[model samples]
Structure formats: structure tokens, C-alpha cells
Target: MASGALAKPQMRGLLAKRLRFHIVGAFIVAVGVACAYKFGVAEQRKKAYADFYRNYDSMKDFEEMRRAGIFQSTK
Candidate 1:
């Protein structure tokens, strides 16, 4: 005639397992997101620098100084 409450085990073990799984999953997801963000930013910066240098025209005015001997060979 006893109640069934004492027949069942506590749910602490299952709860602990579930919590552990959630914690691990969250940690992995955070790491993955951080890496993606970091790589994306790096790629953007790389592309920006490349584009800037590609169109920079550092020697755009070199023709005017070509005959000045300013950059002529010293030999």
C-alpha cells in the first residue's frame, strides 16, 4: 500500500547530463561563431588593402620626372 514515490530514483543524474550537454554545445557554437567573425573581418581588410594598393598609382607622376635624372641609374 506504500506510495510509488519512493520507488523511482531522483532525476538529478538526467538533469546533470542534459546541462552538461547544453554547456558543451554552447561553448562549441561560441567558438565557431568567433572564428567565423574573425576570419570574415580579416578577409574584408585584406580585400580592402588589395584594392587600395591596386588602384593607388604610386608612380602616376613618374613620367614627368623620367628625364630629370632624379631617378636615373647612378651607374
Candidate 2:
């Protein structure tokens, strides 16, 4: 009977440890996924902005605006 009582506490301790490990592992996985998603979004935004600036019409408009003194230094 004493051994049975001891076994129960040991089993409970082991189960608690395992549960904590699983919770921590899940948290790590969630953080990794969030970081990957944020990195992908940043990369997509960078590429889109680069493409926008590379367009011929955009370049022409920029030049026209500059020549019209829109970007003149106020100093």
C-alpha cells in the first residue's frame, strides 16, 4: 500500500512535466510561424515597391515632376 501511494505521486509528477514540455513546444512553434509570416510579408512589400519604381510610366512622371520644380530646394 505504501508503494502504491508513492507510485501515484511519481506518475503525477511525470505527467505534469510532460504537459509542461508540450506547452512550451507549442509556444515555440507558434512563434516560429509568426516570424516566418512576417518575413514573407516584408519581402513581398519590398518586391512590390521595387517593381513600382521600375515601371517606365513611374519614372517619366517622376522626371516631369522634378523638371517642373516640384522638388526644388527651398533653401
Candidate 3:
């Protein structure tokens, strides 16, 4: 009877340790997914900007605006 009582506490402790490890692993995976999502968004924005600048008409319009003094002076 004394041995049975001792075994219950040991089992509880082991279960608590496993639960903690599982929680930590889940948190790590969540952080990794968030980082990947952020990187993907940044890459997509960069690609979009690159495509916008690749068109000759856009560059010509920007140059015209610059000559017309629409942008702030650099001093």
C-alpha cells in the first residue's frame, strides 16, 4: 500500500514534465511559422516593387515629375 502511494506521485511528476516539454515545442513551432510568414510577405513586397519599376513608362513619369519640382528639394 505504501509503494502504491509513492508510485502515484512519481507518475504525476512524470506527466507534468512531459506536458511542459510539449508546450515548449508548440511555442517554438508557432514562432517559426510567424517568422516564415513575415519573410514571405517581405519577399512578395520586394517582388511587387521590382515589377513596378521594370516598366519604362513609370520611370519616364517619375523623371517628368522630378523635373517639374513635385518632389521635395534635397538642398
Candidate 4:
């Protein structure tokens, strides 16, 4: 009935607003860190792929794998 009628008023003014600002700032920092990590990983993948394709020899790799018994054909 009047359960929340004396709930000490939902926290107003400076301290409450400061808490909100701090939370928002922390959220922004977390997002920034996540984006930085994402971009770093993407750059690493790009470099790895670039290095891989830089000297890619498809048939050479296929024959190597075949020699290693990967195909089970004994070729």
C-alpha cells in the first residue's frame, strides 16, 4: 500500500549525479578498451594473412600434406 512512501526519496542532486557520471565514464572507458583490443586483433590477423599469402604455394602445401599422410591416400 505505502511501502515505498517512506523510501528516503530516490537520491537526488550532486552525489547521485556524480555517481551517474562516474558510471558513464567507466562505461566509455570499457568500450574504448574493447574497441582498441578488437582493432589490435584485427591488425594482427591482417598481418598474419598478408604474411601467409606473401609466399603462398598451394600445390606445394598440398603435396606436403599428402606426404604427411593427411589424405590417407598414400600418394
Model 3 Cα lDDT, one tens digit per residue, 1-75: 455544445664798899899999999999999899878897889989999878759667878888888888721
- Model 1 has a clash total of 0
Better of 1 and 2 by lDDT: 2
> What's the lDDT for candidate 2?
0.82
Candidate 2 per-residue C-alpha lDDT over 1-75 given as tens digits, one digit per residue, 9 for 90 to 100: 455544445664798899899999999999999899878887889988998777659667878888888987621
The best candidate in terms of lDDT: 4
TM-score, per-candidate, Cα-based: 0.46, 0.44, 0.45, 0.61
lDDT of each: 0.80, 0.82, 0.82, 0.89
Model 1 has an lDDT value of 0.80
lDDT of 1 by residue, 1-75 (tens): 876665676676898998999999999999999899878898889989998888666566565566566676632
What root-mean-square deviation over C-alphas does model 3 reach? 6.0
Give the poorly placed runs of model 2, Cα more than 4 Å off. 1-9, 46-75
Worst 10 residues of 3 by lDDT: 1-10
Error of 4 at 21 (Å): 1.1
TM-score of 4: 0.61
Question: Which 10-residue window in model 1 sums to the lowest lDDT?
Answer: 66-75
